[model samples]
Target: MSCATLFPRLLGDVGGTNARFGWQAAPGQALQNIRVLACADHAGIDLAIEHYLHSEGLDRPRAACLGIACPVTGDSVRMTNHHWAFSVQALQQQLGLQALRVINDFTALALSLPDLPADSKIPVGGPLRGAEQAPVALIGPGTGLGVSGLLPSQGQWLPMAGEGGHVTLAARTALEFETLQVLQHRFGHVSAERVLSGQGLEDLHAALRCVRGDTAPQQPLDAAGITRLALQQGESSCLQTLDMFAVFLGRVAGDLALTLGARGGLFIGGGIVPRLLGWFEHSGFRREFEDKGRYGVYLAEVPVWVIHTEHSPALWGAARALDQLH
Candidate 1:
């Protein structure tokens, strides 16, 4: 069966905070009527889809594929950061679709690596060595941290989905070590996600205050407020927090690259990094990325790109996966 036979397939990238939907009219055709719906606005996945279709004046699709922000080990899926939960088979039946494929969002992102347009990404540091055949690492921080990788096997790209963000965060500098100590005292385990996410930014600000022995506000600013103060107003605490966040992100990215031997490249996605591109480009991200003592030269040879595309790669990956089914 050709993808043309599956005209008007539904492609969705369902994240913890928002759900993006698009209509793939045919194979190789551009996605149409793409819209993002807040997950909180809907009661369940079924309602969100229904509202999207109705708003777009689209007909019921024959088949659908959703790249969801959770492990799709079976038919049932419970989002890690959201309240939406449903069974795949039951939802398919409810929507009267012939086929429904659900996959991990990070895995979908890994699958889209080959298709990522050059203009859609901004190179962070290092030369583009063109190690296309080697493995590629994917890590992003949003409502939570997501980690995955793409391995080239035979003539196909295989996506690896794992909880790499939950690994113990390594600290090199005195400030980083102090911050880690503070985090460990408060949260015990102190996973990388604890200091690299939206809430993580807020937590980092509070930790910095504790380290400096400064008085903290009764209620510190949220992630957005902190970002605004740092980028627009030049608040010292917010700026320091963002700087540490970038450095920590780079350290974690380097570890992941070394662990996976991701010489092909490292790609950064998610909602946060792209917003602070200016500061991130000038921060210690590249330095930390190549801070591996003996392996510094090797990491320097590897390229790092931050995805800046308006359309979600996960949505594109879902469409590609649906085409593969045919």
Candidate 2:
């Protein structure tokens, strides 16, 4: 269904890190007034929307859809990684929107997979052709790891709602085994998200430092800092850390691809990955991805892509959801 009817409506993709806002101008029209606002600066969703609307001198939109990082079970939603909480109905009333829709951020992203342009994605590995009919996997490492899929069935792509990121991650090989052992002592269960998320990058560095007998390490580095240090061209430690991250990411992506038989390709979203694309394309990620015992050949043919669009995907997905409802 075309989104023309939702024209001039407000769309938001809210996350723990940033809140992306946009307006759907018309069916097949480019989303406009795209803006990213720091969620930490606002006290709540209403205030955040108010700040954006007031700053732009815009009127309250007729219809609104929010792609929130937290689960939208009922009226209230409490973000898992942020301190924000509010009721959807209340927000609609406060904003005077005729209809308001809210969905999980990852689910929203899954919806927009079929709509992303070729220029917005970068291929990391695998066959690029004939992926249109295969199931697509979507995974991202941000405030938390998100995993979902778009399964094509009977001509329409259906979104799969599952917690694939929470699955157990087994460490193969000596070095990876050592990293696992180091992390096991700190956290009981070592899920993939534990080592592939923002804090996961730091956890990897710390684990490596500990394994290498590096004096317990000092200085707390965020994900970006760790990536910057790795991409500095000559930092051995940072390079090792990034290599570890890339390989692990590939392994995770490969596993997801195999689990879903996602020959349609695996799309990487979230705030990370895009900056480290150059390093990723040259890393051991591809080799590790196709390292699955005998099923390696099957995975070797599946494509992988990185969603690099700055557009508010969740907003678009939310709009899609609204259109589906109508």
Candidate 3:
């Protein structure tokens, strides 16, 4: 089957909090009928897709592709943050589609990297010296920390789908070490997600308060509350939390860049970082990203860009994957 035969394909990016749907009416055509629905409102993925199609008054697509938040290792898919679980084949059959592709959300994001428009991204640090053929790294903190990379091979971008976010975090300073120790004691394993994600923001704030011998509030602040207080209200503890979060994110991103030798560049995505753009520019993020002592010069040449595209790149990527299926 060719892309021509797969007209009116369904494309989706299903995150932990929301699910975005789009339609591709023809080959090489732009997506249409883009819609976002809260994940909580639907009992399962099928219902959400059904509701989207019904609400849009669109016909059932012959082919579909979804960039899902969970790993797509097998037929069974269980979201890490939500309660949705189903077999890919079963759902494909239920949707009455000729083909269905399910891929990691970060993989979809990575796949869309090459096609990202310049206006959609804002550079953070380093010179614009991206190698034409080198790998590109991607790291983002959203409902969870997502990590992936795009390796150029045979003139095609291959997306990695590793669980790099769950890797154990490293601390560089005494204060950072103390905070990690506190988290380790509570969570047993202190992955980067423990300090970089939304819930992680709350955890870091609460832990910093404990480490500083500050009075503990009866209840901890949520991620949004902390961000609001830090950005808008100028709360001391919230400010500290945001600073620490940016620094930690820098370290993790640098580590990934080194691991992948991402000389092409490193791109930051997800729902959180874009909101703190102004603060992130002045934070220790760039300093720590280039703080790799011996390799500081090497990293200094590698640029970092934060993706700020209004449209969903995951949807574009899923559409790309569906195109490849032909």
Candidate 4:
């Protein structure tokens, strides 16, 4: 079925690993359909859409908004890690969508911050701002790292759309510098995403293994698998991995907070953080976030939170983006 023939416009959050789809049956209403279609499963966007629709018993949607992990430039969107590429206008015409919107996944997540339900988030450190002037920062890691900020303006929040995650991942300690050196050998131009994400955690484990004189596993381990091992209560190596991931995330989060002046506070989101909530709060994340030189006190005052919403945020962000059309 073509998108023109479907009712209840579809909204999607297409990331490096999964493509989440849903429908806005009415204004401000989010009807979700979690489709675990790997990008590697389909040949292209159209085929993926068809598979999702057939599996969900839906026809083509009219107005659609797709939140992709890659930067949305011009009419073409080619994913960085996934082998998927498509022309927006051409796909809209092919699907018969009246209107189609494409936005970066992180940007969409940032847009959904203001409307996030209280139950969806858990405060990590300090209190959030009561005033509307403060800016909020969103940082997440999954297939890659994502960063964005939102500032209050014109009676609503305005989200910043930039590639802040790809910026240099700074190290303030000798051990961290060593980790950077190890990673630099594997991936030449290392970014924050290289060290602060799931893949980074695995890499950290591999390096730690090397440092401990144990051969690292040749087969790759998924993010959840590593996190589970760490959270199991008796595995020292996994615990070390989790601890390092948290501390480094704290350092990076602090960097993002300083860069954006996120007085409203910082948020931790992504596929991994929520699962390690306990470890994160008890780990060096909060302390490291406030470890800046003279500005330590200033950063200490800024609050940080972890998003616990299990419904997924990028989808809500896509819906929020769609609401902006009015």
Give the per-residue Cα lDDT of candidate 4 at 190: 76
For residues 100-172, what per-residue lDDT tens digits would candidate 1 score against the true structure?
Answer: 8888888888888898988987999988654868999999998788899999999788888787878989888
Each prediction's Cα lDDT score?
0.89, 0.83, 0.91, 0.79
Q: Which stretches of candidate 1 lie over 4 Å from their true place?
A: 1-4, 216-218
Q: Which candidate is the best by TM-score?
A: 3
- List residue ranges in candidate 4 displaced over 4 A: 1-7, 32-34, 128-131, 216-220
Candidate 4 per-residue lDDT over residues 64-136, each given as its tens digit: 8888888887899898668899999899998887878899988888888887788877877766553357888
Tens-place lDDT digits, model 3, residues 1-326: 76546868999988888899999988778889999999999999999999999999999899999998888899999999899999999999999989999999999889899999988888999886598899999999998899999999999998999889899999889999999998999999999988889889999998998899988555779999999999998999899999999999999999999999999999999889998988888889999999999999989989999999777898998888776776
- Of models 2 and 4, which has the larger lDDT? 2
Give the top-scoring candidate (lDDT): 3
> Which lDDT tens digits does candidate 2 get at residues 200-255?
88898888888898895379777888888778755787788888888888899888
What's the residue-level lDDT of 119 in candidate 4?
A: 82
Q: Model 1 — which ten-residue stretch has the worst lDDT?
A: 1-10
> Which RMSD does model 4 reach against the true structure?
3.1
C-alpha root-mean-square deviation, each candidate: 1.6, 2.2, 1.2, 3.1
Ranking by lDDT: 3, 1, 2, 4
The clash count of every prediction, one per candidate, is 0, 0, 0, 4
Worst ten-residue run, lDDT, model 2? 1-10
In terms of lDDT, the poorest run of 10 residues in model 3 is 1-10
TM-score of 4: 0.92
